[model samples]
Target: MAKVKSLDDLKKIKEEFLSKEELQKNGDKSLGIVQIKVAMATCGIASGAKKTMDYLINELDNRAIDAVVTQTGCMGYCYAEPTIEVTLPGKEPVVFGYVDEKRAGDIIEKYIQGGELVGDVIPVNYETIEEHNIE
Candidate 1:
């Protein structure tokens, strides 16, 4: 193998591998705003998780929303197959369940863009922890 002669050659190679154009074109910045994650569990995948993922990617690309989409393992909510997680800047992450392509669109539109909570919220376990007992 040919050794890199100098810093300039290494830089050129690095530029090619991590090119701005390529990053913008293929990196996880297409959404340009939020980050999306779909739980591709066995049940989720069986229930068409990939389709939902594609819908989100296409929708974001079509609308030119800057965001990144990733896949995760079982979210432990198997009953709610095809679950999704949305992480907005400066906000707590939200997990949605029983999501399909249509619901995916709704999520993108309502939560991601409109900032309105959509339907089908995964019921959370709220335990009241008494901070201090009054005398």
Candidate 2:
């Protein structure tokens, strides 16, 4: 870490740290924004989820898209390692598998930006507890 030389520098460092902390927390849920969760478990990492995530972060920022890219644990789709879950505001979340850098770009361009569905969609097989009213 670089030493802060002045108050302005300290503020900049704090802002940067807060930004990274927000990404790690994955709690950005502002309405009307896209939310992306990249699976980063052991299998996911081995399959290059880190690269995929970096691509997503960079592409989204480059395109000036309003999106939150965050890391998540295993999505239980080990067969489809490097998976990602995308949630458009006011829409249900969609899970896509086998994501690479190219595919990540496509996802941002087509799905996130253009509001179109792309390939490699993994169907949601399990129901949430809310669906079953198991409270």
TM-score of each: 0.67, 0.74
- For model 2, residues 71-126, the per-residue Cα lDDT tens digits are 99999999887899998866778999989998888888899878899979999999
**Would you list the C-alpha lDDT of every candidate in the order shown?**
0.81, 0.86
What are the clash counts of all predictions, listed in order?
6, 0
Q: Best candidate, lDDT-wise?
A: 2
Q: What is the clash count of model 2? A: 0
Cα lDDT for residue 77, model 1?
A: 86
Whole-structure CA lDDT of model 1: 0.81
- The candidate 2 region of ten consecutive residues with least summed lDDT is 22-31
What TM-score, to 2 decimals, does candidate 1 have?
0.67
